[model samples]
Target: MWNKLFVDHPRTVQESYGEHAVMAASFGGRMVLAGLACLVHAVVPGLFVRTGSRTITVLYDEMVVNRNRKANKAAGEVAAVGGR
Candidate 1:
């Protein structure tokens, strides 16, 4: 149960438990801030017009692009070691 709760997803993501926790918290914090900005922009319609979308795009790139790079690197390293 402990492994299921803490270890499995992080391993799939190539992060340790603590690293995953910290990263998840950071993503949540950023999303909350972006949501607040979106709320304000809905009423003001001029301020922070780009903040929410920009944040989402940046986060998506970070999560998808960077993670794929990491996974590919890891796979390459494993293949090299196995070939050796």
Candidate 2:
């Protein structure tokens, strides 16, 4: 049960438990900071004009693009071995 609840998703993403925890925490922290920047920008137009969007782009690249690339590479490796 514990493995299913905690390890499965992390392993699927090619990260160990600690690594996944750190990555998730980092993403959460960045998102919170970005949200705060957006809130401030909402009140004051001059401040943080591009901070929120930039943060979103960076996070997307790190979390989605990189993860997809890793998954694809692993899949390709498995396919190559299977085909051989």
Clashes of each: 0, 0
TM-score for each predicted model, relative to the true structure: 0.91, 0.80
For candidate 1, list the clashing residue pairs, or say none.
none
Candidate 2 achieves a global lDDT of: 0.94
Give candidate 1 misplaced runs (Cα > 4 Å): none
For candidate 2, the TM-score is 0.80
Which runs in model 2 stand beyond 4 Å of their true positions?
A: none
Tens-digit per-residue lDDT, 1-84, candidate 1? 999998999999899999899989999999999999999999999999899999999999889986998799999999999999
